[model samples]
Structures are given as C-alpha cells and as structure tokens.
Target: MKRSPMKPGKPLVRTPFKRTSPMPSTGMLSVQSHQRTAPKRKAGLKSKGPVSTPIRRAARGQDCTLRLTVCNFDPDTTVLCHSNYLADGKGMGLKAPDTAAAFGCSACHDVLDGRRPRPADLSLAGLEAAFRAAVSHTHEILRSMGLLDAAPAAIQPTLEHP
Candidate 1:
C-alpha cells in the first residue's frame, strides 16, 4: 500500500484544496482596445455613419471613478489579496491593513489558492447613489412600458418628465 510521507524534521504534509475567487470575478471584463475618444454607435439601424454626438451620459455609466478597499497581503498565509492590479494598487509593498467597515483581514481572505475559503466583498451601500440612479432609470423604463404607475419615490427628485 502507498503511504503519505513526512520528513524527519517536518510536519506531515496536508494537501491543500483548490481555491476559488471570492468576488464574482470580473476577470473576463477586459479592455478590448484603448479608445482615444470612445466608440460611437448608431442610434438605429437605418442611420449610416456613427452618431455625431459624443456618448450620452447613460452610455458612459462606467466613466465614474469608484474606490475599492483592498488588502495587499495576508501575512499569515503569504497570499496576495489583490482583486485587480489597478483596483488593488500596482506592484508590491505591504498595505497598512485598514480594515474597511465591511471587512477584516482574515475574514476577507477566507479562500486562498483553490480552497473553499471565505471571500468578502464590499456592500453596495457604498454605491448608494449609483444604485439609486440605476433603479430610477429602470423604474422609468418600466413606467414608460405601462408596467409601473410612477417612478419610484426615491427617484422622484431626479425625474425629469414625471
């Protein structure tokens, strides 16, 4: 029978399980090409050339800068806690471990490598303004479709036509 081995001076090796991303990975969201101006699209199929005007506000939803809380390293595990290079900050150097309101070091890094580790993510409450705006837009779409009686009360102040 085969047996697992332990060295004379070392502890028995425990094979680690595979780890998975804690965050709903946006890994596939990559830059197709760096746009100097931004791609222009036609408003309708019948239009020949691209729309003359710059992208509309709604089309530029991702233009806003957002802060991301990041932990550079887990000293205990010797693992990096970066979500993305830009999101986590470029290059290597230990971070102060600020412990964002929603996450502490250990809990935020439940998973390492391929193991079923804990993964912590920031709450959407931090983006309350954006979320409210999105919901308001969605409500308007629904209202225009006759599915809603009116735009939601939260979005009322920003409602242009309603």
Candidate 2:
C-alpha cells in the first residue's frame, strides 16, 4: 500500500495499474465490416418486424369488452390488453399479439394482469370464459372499424343523375 505524503498514513485515491501483457488483437480491420453486431436471438425465437401498433392505438376511447364486475367502463381508460393465455402466445417476458387482445379498462386490465383480485363470484374458469368472449367482442369492433383483415367490404353508394 502506498501512503499519502500529506497524511503520512492515508493511502492515495487510486493504486497505480500495472500491465503484464500487451493488448490482445483480432486482426487487421476489414473494409466490409467495422461496426458492432447485435447479439443472436435465443433458439426458436424470431422477430417478424414490430407488433401491430395501429390496432393498439385504435383501442383508445373504445368501450371495455371484458365488462367484468371490476370493469370501470370508462372509455378514456380503455386500451388493448393482450391475452394472458399461453395458447394465445403469452409467455414469460413476451406478450400475446394485438390480434389476440381485447378492449379493456384499467380495472379489467388489472384483474386480468393479476394486479387486482377478481370478483368473489367469479372463478378462474369463469374469468377465462369472460376473457374469450371479450376477445371476440373486441374483434367484432375491430372489424367494424375496418382495422382487421376479416372486416366486410364497405358498400359504395352510387348517385342517379337526371
């Protein structure tokens, strides 16, 4: 240990670093590649571009489809809540796709997300059934809004001129 001259006993802020070997090198830099590369994704996981942002944004101001006893039914609080079911592609650190989502209020979202307790009369099976129904209802709304691919074609009005 090196002592400070001023204090006579206190050590300096940092100990001097000693190098035992020269810095390692890979090779000469190539003209084709100089930038760092991203880490590889885990096996079986693949990104197909970003998730549906338009559908998510369209959820704003929509009615709560879950309509659980805990549902606030506030349009201002309505948003697209992804499915919690594993069959819907939900997994740890991964959410279900927007197509599998439903329009839900903050209260319903909390119940589905397990942040809040479900209704006393509602069982796990009942909750699951309700979520499935809500998903269907949400899909209907999306279809009516022409957001989903399964939406029916709009009828064009023709004018009869004299």
Candidate 3:
C-alpha cells in the first residue's frame, strides 16, 4: 500500500463527511445531528433592508435628513406610517405621504406617542416662519453643494396633498 507524505507532527485519521452548523461546539459533532430543531421563524419587516429611502442622491453636500435620520419614524415597524416616501424623496414636496419630515406633524404622533402635535403643517399660519426657515435651509443646502446654480424652483407648498 502506498502512503502520502505527512508533515512533522500531523495526524492521518480522516473524519466522515457531514455538514456542520455555524453554532458553537457542543462537545461532540454527533450531538449536532441529533439536536432538536426549533420551528423556523420567518424573517420579519422590522429586520429589514431599507425603508424611506431617497430617489435622487441628495444634491452634492446636502444631508438627506429624510433618508439618513430614520431612527424616529421606522417605516418598517409602523403599519400606520403610510410609506410613500421610500420610492424617492417625494415627501419633501410636502405633497406626498412619504417625504414629510419638516412638513408632517403627523409623524410626531408616530414617534412621540401623540404627546406632541405635528410640528410643521403648512396649513397652520404659525408655521409660516418654520416653513420659510425650511426654504432657507433648502436653499443653503443646495448652494453649498453647488446644486443651486440652476436651482430647482423654490417649493411652494399648497393645501393640496398629493
């Protein structure tokens, strides 16, 4: 019988072929084969890939507050949180159901458990100051990133909800 070459201190015994789990060792590999299998749990929405994502990349340096700051309104967890925002930054227009961070007080109800009313409703006269601030913020955000050169028209929100 011919034998293959061996290194200085290696063994020659080979184990039978079988699949092993990625779990920690349980003293014996055989134990894995005999172990009870739990019911397979379905991966759910909360453990998701991404929700409320943006359409276009935030022009240049503009921080996509809608997409980036999502710890509050997790579209995954809330069934009530009508997610029209994920396809694109549509809610930013304040016309759609999705991109309404600076525009939706309704979202405050989602995160704050209804303790605080919606912060930025265009209908409220008091929020005009806030609305202008948002416009300015948008303008500055665009200018800084060099996207304002051919600036998209300033968004003039109406009572209309698209």
Candidate 4:
C-alpha cells in the first residue's frame, strides 16, 4: 500500500505560461495607442461659457447638505453635486448649472443621482423635495462664502400709458 502526500484536487507541479502579443513584430502602433497620442478636442467654449469650475472647487471641505439616510457625511467626499432634474438644466449627457448644485457626500450623491437605491422611508417625491432643500441650503452656503451672486428678483412688466 502507498500513501500520497499531495492534497486532494491539488496539482503537485506547476508551470508558468507565457502570453504572446497579437501585434506584429514590425512595431506598428495600435489603434488605441494612436488614439491616445492624438490631441483631444476640449468640450464647451470656456470664453463666456457656463463652465464654473470655481464653484465646484468651493465645495471642497463643505458639509453634505443632501444628508440622506445613506449620507457618509465625510467632508473629503463632498462636492457640488448638480441637480439631475431637467428643470435645473440637467439632460442627456449634460449636467445642471452649478448654481443648482448641493454639497453632497459620495453616498448621498449616489442616492440623489439614482446610482444607489433610495432609502426605504423616502418616496420619489420626498427624495426630490429633500434634494431641492439641500440645493437651497447649499446656495446659502455658497452665497455666504461669496462664491455665488444673490438670488435673482422677479421682473414685473409695466403697462405703458397711451
């Protein structure tokens, strides 16, 4: 009778496998490499454009206004999370204006952006309301920090006399 020292379903010997590149030996550049080296066109004209990087940068170290049940409340993860509603200018492949943003931690941002599920206690309308409230609170914070202008006033049209 003989006994085996090797464990069951285990290989007693192993060998390293070498992988070969699919590219030709002539050093022809790959499509991906060529694309990577190509100059990229910057999106959106910054001159008189809607781009507001300063406002986004101001969100750093700010408290999460969208304090959802899933909120992390970690200042490091906070940022100016833009509103996803179309009324706020959010659309396909487009973000809302920075003014319509709220300071949100990663978790709360995920929930607000629909990347994570909403809390059990909150309905769709409730979530929307909470996000709106957070946006308003963040606006006040930004205004206090001098990052935003005062809220615009309603314009009334005057009747002209004959």
Candidate 5:
C-alpha cells in the first residue's frame, strides 16, 4: 500500500465542487435602504384632527398657575406656559402623548428648552422629575375636561433610567 504525501491526519483526496456566482445585488442588502422607505399607512383612514387640539383644549380657560419649578421659591415670577419645548426641535410636542404637553411657566420652559441656562441648584434628573410630574398633572386635567378617558390606565413614560 502507498502512503499519501499529505499529513497523516489530513484527507488524501480534495473534493471537486463548482463555486456559484455571487448573489444578485438587491438594494435591500443594507438596513438603511429599508429604513429610508416610509411606513405604510392603514387601509382605512381614521382622521384624528391636529394632535395639539386635545392638549390645547385641556389647558384652555385654565390659568397656568402650575408650579413646575424645582423650588417653589418665587411664585410671582412664573408666567403662563403652553407647550413643553424639546431641547432638539425635531418632534416638538409630538414625541410624547398629549399628556406630556404640560403648562410650564416661562422660567421652567426656558430651562427645559435650553433657551436659558439651567440653574446650578437644579440637576437634569430633578428637571426630568418635575417634567414627569407636570405630565401627570396634565393627564389629570385632560381627564377632568373629558378630553381623555379616565377609565383607561395612563401610558407609561418611554424614557427609562439606567
């Protein structure tokens, strides 16, 4: 018997197989391409008027005396607030539900919107805590006004802490 020249553990014969051509280049290969496409709308269209209508109606005729400040030190300085402006102006009030839009005073709104520098005494966590409280308050107001159903449970905040 003749010993194979290859290593003792290695196979003596190589398998003959034809290599197939590369796959067709469909643009779908990259995830970005899929994401670039707009989401499909539902078959039957349900018209929910402007998103701000409910929030505005809820706060309408009501005084913006809600204290959003971390410390209720200066009550007189607080001004009427409408929308809680996002730091980045991308989505504005649309990021969160109508409940998230609370009547914050000008001072507090400025701090949140980065129009005015945040006070050294207040931390980001404290500001966020205040915002959540405002959202909850707005939810209650909406319920009272009959804009939102009181029967259903409130939606949880999307922002999570580590």
Candidate 6:
C-alpha cells in the first residue's frame, strides 16, 4: 500500500462541544460561571454597618498608643490577639467571651497561631499563661475606663466569711 504525505502547515480540525444554549459573552461555560455574577440581594433587607464585637469595643476604649501586652516587645505597633484555643476550634465549647482577647505584636501573634516556631526558652504553656494574663489586664483596663460593665457582686468573693 502507498502512503500519502501529510500536510506540513495545516492543523487538525477538532469537533466543538455542542451545548443546548450559547455560552456567555465572557467566554466561560455558563453552568461553571454562574457564581462569577454578583449575588442578588433579598428584598426588604437593608444593609447594616459592621457590628462591634466585645474585643473591638474593649480595645477601642484603651489608649491607642499602648504596646503589645504579651511580649511588650513592640511599643509602637500592636494588634488584637485572640486566644489560640479560639483559633484552634477548642474554645468554642468554653465560656470565654470575646473580651478574652488580648493585644500582641505580629511576631507573638504568629507564634500563638503556630505559623512560626516558638522561642527556644518559651513553651506553649508559658505563652498561653502570658496571653491569659494580658487578657486579664486588658479587662481591667477596659473596666477602669468604664467600657466593660462591672462584674456582678456575686462573682466577686467577699473577704468576710459568715
């Protein structure tokens, strides 16, 4: 049998996939691109501003120039730091409120979040203790500033025992 020479420049033709309807103008497949469109808002629903969380409320009540409470390493820059337990999904079952959050620098926050390795001398337990202490201090500061409501008398122990 004699073989025919193939064309040097011509490309093979491909059969286009058939669709019940034409694809969108964006050139994306219709079904896969549905989510790319903006979502429709429900009727009678008004957009509201961001709701203030307890942590934010407490932080705002403090002096903006304050340093990170955990390491006290950064005096000029600080950010809110929530409990590692909270970020780890373990604090959901605990009674700790949003006010339990403390202030820390990016490094300390990273360490707490396990994104960075802990210091050679510092243990996870030590860091947690420091965070808790910072939270307590923050609460006190908030309380002194009249941001947080006073603790219930029942929760405070009396020195005099009946």
lDDT of each: 0.34, 0.88, 0.40, 0.86, 0.58, 0.61
Q: Is candidate 3 or candidate 4 better by TM-score?
A: 4
Prediction-by-prediction clash tally? 9, 0, 3, 0, 0, 0
Question: Could you give candidate 1's per-residue lDDT for residues 34-144 as a string of tens digits?
Answer: 335866976654545433222111222221112223433333422212221233333354332211111113323333212333225544343443323433444454356
lDDT of 4 by residue, 1-162 (tens): 599677899867655953345566567765654322666768763455546598899989999999999988799999889988899899987888898889999999999888999999999999999999999999899889898889889998999999
> Residue 102 lDDT in model 5?
66
* Range of the 10 consecutive residues with the lowest summed lDDT in candidate 3: 62-71
TM accuracy, model 1: 0.19
Model 1: number of clashes?
Answer: 9
Q: Over the stretch 10-40, how does candidate 6's per-residue lDDT look in tens digits?
A: 8877679655565658865556544346789
Q: How well does each candidate superpose onto the true structure, as a TM-score?
A: 0.19, 0.62, 0.25, 0.65, 0.45, 0.51
For residue 115, model 3's alpha carbon misses the true position, in angstroms, by 14
Q: Extract clashing residue pairs from model 4.
A: none
Which candidate has the highest lDDT of all?
2
- lDDT of prediction 5: 0.58
Candidate 2 at residue 87, lDDT? 96
Candidate number with the higher lDDT (2 or 4): 2
Identify the runs in model 4 with alpha carbons over 4 angstroms from their true place: 1-52, 154-162
Per-model C-alpha RMSD: 24.0, 13.2, 17.5, 11.5, 16.7, 9.4
Candidate 3 wrongly placed segments (more than 4 Å): 1-56, 59-116, 119-123, 150-162
- Candidate 4 — what's its lDDT? 0.86
Question: By TM-score, who's the top model here?
Answer: 4
The count of backbone overlaps in candidate 6 is 0
Model 3, span 47-123: residue lDDT tens: 54434433223422333223211235433332212223334244553333322223222333243333445354333
Model 2 agreement with the true structure over 48-152: per-residue lDDT tens digits:
665658899998899999999988879999989999889999998788999899999999999999999988999999999999999999998888888897955
